[model samples]
Target: MGVCTSQNVQEKIDNIEDDYLKLDFNRFSTYQKLENIANNIAKQQQVDTIFSSLIQRMIASGQGHILKILENIDNQKKLGFMTKLERLDFEFIDSLFHHCYKQNQIDAFQCNVIQSTNCQEQNFDLIKEHKVGIVFLCGGRSSRLSDKLLSDIGLPSKKCVIQIMMERLKKILMLSSENKEINDYPIAIVLSDQNQEKFQMYLKSQRDFGFQSINFILEKSLPVIDCKGQVVFEQETQAIMTPEGTGTIFLQINSFINKFPNMEYIHFLGLDNLVGLPLDPQMLNLISKQKADVLCKVIETNSILDDRIFYSNRQFKTMDEQDSNITENSYNSTQMLLNDLYLSVSFLNNLKYNHEKALKLNQRYHYIKRGSNIQFEKHIQDIIEVTDITILHQTEDYALLIDDPRKAVIQLSNVHKRYLKLEGTQEEDLVEITPQMSYCGEDLRKFENVSYPLII
Candidate 1:
């Protein structure tokens, strides 16, 4: 008798296939299939003894899907991105595989709702009392928008989305100074390695957009894998690496907080949302009064409660593919206000732990294609099982996510008019409203008499 091994099992499978014509078809039985499966499991255990880690344990303990993939990679001796297994960064991809193979389970919790009508308007005093931070998620590539960075997408004023957002921040700073809160707002921009250089070059050209200091958080870029779990390469020399996901932003939350010890809340803004108002005055007042730990700005589709999706007890789920149960009436704007004090290191670690443990059952996986390769991603909104959430019902005017050139022109123009409040201006008017002129729709009546094509 010979000692069994994965290599031996592979040879056996090959031999069986090679001799298929010689075998008696009626001799095959369920007992033989069960015997082969048991043998493979034993061989996997022997192979896993070489490494000590949860990742290895997962391959050994679970069905031999991952083990089979690795075996095929080894036999081929040529991965698309790299030539050998030793060249791969196993440690870096440990979590990726851990998440890819596990069953995801999101615990349900209750939610608290806050109506827009009940929220106090313009509570500047409350904002001045606490320290706040802004996190701009801009790691995304232009994708359908174009080859240009999403931050560089032009608005009606000839200013890009990044410029507009910075101007809005500058206005907040000015308001804080007027209220005697002179501390500079700690702002962080999450960027991927692919776009970091370009973004920095743009910022340098604009003199950091007049900011005294800005903190930049670089997101982890991982190699894209194909359907067969082989790394995909863009060209002959380089492997294509893509930004992990929006949820990966949470990994840096603790470090960002440590830098700004006094930050009480963080306003999350998405790069695609051209009209998002970070640290909104009304939102600030509602969260402050209610002392809610998490705030999700949602849009209601109908007046009926049963027809709408509510974040009851924090059990509300994001509209991701993983969520089988979806109510179409209401959805989130992807903007959120998170209480910094509520986000401790242990709490975030626990979330990460649970995220890795929770997996899709029945061995199902979802993949998205990017250009020439496919990748997996986990969204932040999908795993937000916070203790309590305050849902702010807002109009769709606040949820304009620009993804196409045609939509950008029409939607941005309409939002500009709404914010500027130039009543007499026609729908086709090219109104340019800068943050210096008005922070947020504050008595912009002066622009009413300006002209058909007014630039403020």
Candidate 2:
């Protein structure tokens, strides 16, 4: 066969192997079952050789590991162990292991100081000229945010972050429009499995912020493994899975870009930054002037231990307090501009694997608990090591909700008061500036007698 669907290959395996239901692995008592399944697939003339080899590789490498983990456990107890991996999605695991087996190396570049400059365009002329899209890295799980949805975290005046983001975008579009026809900018939001449904419901309730087009992309999830390299599971049919790091953005880049004909660029941003986005023409123009494949916004930071610190001008290495490479300052702001034309699955995959290997060796892992399991994530910023990125320097002036939500409210209020030129305004004042009122606290002077804690 030239090519076969996963389902087709699965059916062929099922026809030849009697006991591998759903590839549960637990159903088979011996490693021989796995060997038989792989051998049968290879023996079939109708099955693709590539698929057969991949299946064989899976069996050859995974069988021993699987057996060693659940070695002495009884069959009933092993079944209860519940390693219900995605039955049909073996290719994903195969790709993952393939990366593990093959070391994709990134050459260290010569370290140099990244120059920063400013650009300003009141008309958003550059956005109108390019096939632009916005990506919100909103895949953060709500479990870490006080068990609340990221969209539901209320800002001052009970306005949620999602609402504010929508308002700001609407304002930008209106400001850019000349003929009164606001351009519908395509927005791609990367959401995680944990909060995707609830976030969708919230968006639906808000009528998708009155936008004509919005694309919700689920981030890729990785299986959780123990310290001993054994896969962990939560239930009989569900393995413990966590969202893959920001690197997954590449996995969906082509698909998201293809959604809009000739989509040229995408502005990747973090949703938790409450101050707002600088999606003006100047930023877009800067990228064009630099002729860069990527533009990353960084803020000056003197702390060597800050997790956001990106170091080594050539390698673009991320440093921790324990890492010997903490000789530099500055932090990745999670704000980036990318040319979609230069991005491809193969290129980014290699970058991702290389970056992840580096991260693992550096012990830059955050252990989060899910029931009885703990998992580590791969960060996407490591692409900085392999790509030429123009750095945009700016001061820290925003409230990031990645940590404490309560503090974010206080910080948000302080930033809001400063933006609105309200002196000595305390959090108790509850000042609310809707996105409709002002994109960045500029157009709010018209509203008079604004009551305390009310939307202006």
TM-score per candidate, chains pooled: 0.63, 0.63
Error of 2 at 69 (Å): 11
Which residue pairs does candidate 2 place in steric collision? none
State, as a TM-score between 0 and 1, how close model 2 is to the true structure. 0.63
RMSD of each: 10.0, 11.2
Expressed as tens digits, the lDDT of each residue in 369-413 for candidate 1 is: 545455655444433444334444344554244345435545656
Alpha carbon lDDT at 283, candidate 1: 65
* lDDT (Cα, tens digit) per residue for candidate 2, span 314-338: 3433222222322334332332322
Location of the lowest summed lDDT over 10 successive residues in candidate 2: 336-345
Candidate 1: Cα lDDT at 213: 70
